[model samples]
Target: MGDKVVKFEPITHVIFDMDGLLLDTEKVYESIIKKIASKYGKEYTLEVRSELTGRTQVDSAKIAVEKMKLPITIDEYLEQYHPLCREFLQTPDLMPGAEKLVRHLAKHNIPIAIATSGNEWLSKIKTQNHVNLFSEFHHTVYGSSDPEVVNGKPAPDIYLICASRFPDNPSPDKVLVFEDAPNGVEGAYSAGMQVVMIPAPEVEEELKRHATLVLTTMEDFVPETFGLPPYDE
Candidate 1:
């Protein structure tokens, strides 16, 4: 028998996760966290990084401090870390193919939003170098500090809020989320949305199964596969 073609639901709106998916700031975060860990005589391991990825700022700080057994309060860690993050986040470049995809979506009139765990202040700093690119997003939901989002990723609150904010108020099932972290995939799935994960090279295969599609980079994303407009030559 010929193989049956798998069909995916049509996506009317799109959401993007910022740190590792849209921008190259994850490495900057890793470097900063590693430096802090070293100062405390601890190694910032990949397992710990995976745990912290896609969480709100306060949640990540709490997890990191507890996981590393660091002798400091979450507020102290943020006080020291934020300054270093602000220094490097200001100049991070867009990830590969991020601009092209975003432009294509905009040209096609797809409603798009950014749902990042980073607070508003940090989000602005991270996108300072690419203001034009960041501006293309119809709206942004800063999960860590946005008053609307009562819970962060892995809880579905942010994604739900992002979809609701769109002018058309798209249904959760009609939204497609692009993410690079397992927690984001889980959150999107919980929100009844399809998620495409473009994980880092070091991310484990086991953690990628939650996504509707898993790719190595945005360059590999085929919009047509998810019922979105295809890129024109």
Candidate 2:
């Protein structure tokens, strides 16, 4: 498994997905969607969430509304969502080893950035609790607000847009991505970059195949496998 998970090629830059990869906010968003769907006697199961992961706010709203057969417009669903999301986003919890890995990369002068399916407003809200930590990134590309990110995950738009933003405009192969959504892994792969996926518990096995590396938690990441410096501790 170790051999299978490690891609020994050296990578120059790193891109991270925000919600599930670095922050434990995916669960919060999940609960909110489930709660809303339940009002219409619809179930928001793991399979549904797997499909929605890494999708933009509007995109997720559309799937949820349709999948649940909710008697609400996507706009109405979002209106109810924002308020509940606002409260939880401001109090995000970091995923296992997220801070350690990020800081280590930063300390080594690795160019790192965040690329999220969230809009600017949601990004700001989601990152409020860890302003200092998030500031370590070179920049953050918000999918909804970034004109270059015309398409969300399951498309290469966001990853390609993110890689281009780096100072060197590095080749796709030289950039590595960390994601927690199957769509994110596929998107990064489509962009010609190697991705490390830490998928949601219920994501299907088929989706895991897209990742160059997959781990149960951020804690399992070994930078040396990707030719990045190992943790000093």
Candidate 3:
């Protein structure tokens, strides 16, 4: 069969996924997961890592414990992983072009929000070093701990909630989502929003097919193509 042609529609509001999308923290996550997995003599492969991406912390911990056959409880895993994660997450660098794009959108009066699987506490820790960047968002919805978000990525709850929180409460179709995981793409798509995926180099091509647009990095994103204001050159 021929590849499906993806169409771009004008977007009025934007939603961003955190972690790998905005912060260069995916490597820290992979490193920590691998370190923990090694203790149980299990390899933390990219495939398994992909499955855990975009999930809640408890969900991810359960999956890793079960999939890796670790001799540890979910609580135990959290106890070990949380401290290690906090150490590195407190100072994550902004992903390439993330700050520029965010500030550009903010400057243009484009409504922007964040929808992340990371709970409130973890999200705060991760963004501690980049308060100015995050403060540009209209609002942020932390799916893992938000009472309003019943499900994490791969479910439309978080995205829907994010859109509803916007001042205009734009329809899902008018909201454009930026994501870095296949699950995040699926969630945004399921929410009836156009999603631009900036996937890790290690992510499989098949997983990227679901996105309305896919790019190597946020730097490559063209706001004009999506009916947003062009960046000042």
Best candidate per TM-score, number?
3
**TM-scores for all candidates?**
0.96, 0.95, 0.97
Write model 1 residue lDDT over 152-220, tens digit each, in one string: 988899999999999999889899999999999999999999999999898887888678877888998
Off-target runs (Cα >4 Å) in candidate 2 are: 1-7
Query: What local lDDT does model 3 show for residue 111?
Result: 99
Ranking by lDDT: 3, 1, 2
Error of 3 at 206 (Å): 1.5
Model 3: number of backbone collisions:
0
lDDT for 30 (candidate 3): 92
Better of 1 and 3 by TM-score: 3
Please identify model 1 stretches exceeding 4 Å from their true place: 1-6
Best by lDDT: 3
- How far residue 105's Cα lies from its native spot in candidate 1, in Å, is 0.6
For model 3, the local distance difference test gives 0.91
